[model samples]
Target: MANDKNNGQDNLRNAKASASNMYEEGKAGASKMYEEGKASASNMYDEGKDRVNQVYEQGKEKAEEIYKQTKEKASEIYEESMKKVSEAQENLKEYSDELVKTVKEKPLTSLLIAGGIGFIISALLKK
Candidate 1:
């Protein structure tokens, strides 16, 4: 009975040691898995940030290009409008000068024309 008790004690000790070793191995494996998962998450976050930055840069460049084009078109339109206004002013001046010359060259004709225009206007106003 003494020898049997000693064998039983030795068996119990071996089982405890085996259980401890298994526990340590499981803890190590869990720690390694946690580290790997953290590293993967960090890498994914960096990649996403880089992609967003690239998209932002592309948008900025496109916006600048559009702004430049719009400004150039506006300038062209403004210059064209100014040119047309200048031409209209010159034509009006030429017409006024011609009318003055005609009035000076033929005083009787201009007087008759003026009287006729006045009579027509008065007739229209009466209606």
Candidate 2:
């Protein structure tokens, strides 16, 4: 009977020790998982932030490039318009000079033509 009691006590002590070891191992594993999850979350956040920054930089560069191209095209158009205006002014001057020379050479003919044009304009105005 004494041996049996001692053996039973030893079995109970072994079971208790096994339960304690299992509990400790479970706690340690849970702690390790929590730390690993936190590290993974932090790494993901950093990667996302870096990706956003890279996209922003690329967008900014594209916008600047477009702006420069637009500015250059506008400058070229302005120059072309100025050249056309200068050419028109020169043509107008030449036409005026030619008309003046014709008037000086034939004053009576010019006067008659001018009188006819004035009559036509006045007639249109009355209508």
Candidate 3:
């Protein structure tokens, strides 16, 4: 009976030591996982920052290109409008001169045509 009791006590002690060792191992594994997670998160943040900078540079370059194109288009439109305005002014001057000559040479004929047209329009409206 004495020997059996001593063996049992030894077995209980071994079991406790094994349990303590397992607890230590589990704690170490958890700490290692936490460190690895922290490192992975930091690397991801750095990669994201780099991508954002690249996108910003691309957007700025595109905006400058668009501005240059818009300025050139506006200049072309202004030149075309000025050219058209000059042509219209020249045509108006020629028409004005011709009108003055016609009025001077055919005053009575112009008046008679105008009165006849007015009388015809009035007669049609009355009917």
Clash number for each model: 0, 0, 0
Candidate 1 regions exceeding 4 Å error are: 106-127
Top candidate on TM-score is: 1
Q: In candidate 3, what are the lDDT values of residues 1-127, reduced to their tens digit?
A: 9999999999999999999999999999999999999999999999999999999999999999999999999999999999999999999999999988887899998789889999999999999
| lDDT tens readout by residue for model 1, 4-95 | 99999999999999999999999999999999999999999999999999999999999999999999999999999999999999999999
Pairs in steric clash, model 3: none
RMSD of each: 2.9, 3.1, 3.5
lDDT, ranked from best to worst: 2, 1, 3
Task: Compute the lDDT for candidate 1.
Answer: 0.99
TM-score ranking of the models: 1, 2, 3
**Prediction 2 TM-score vs. true:** 0.72
Worst 10 residues of 2 by lDDT: 10-19
Q: After superposition, how far is residue 99 of candidate 2 from its true place, in Å?
A: 1.8
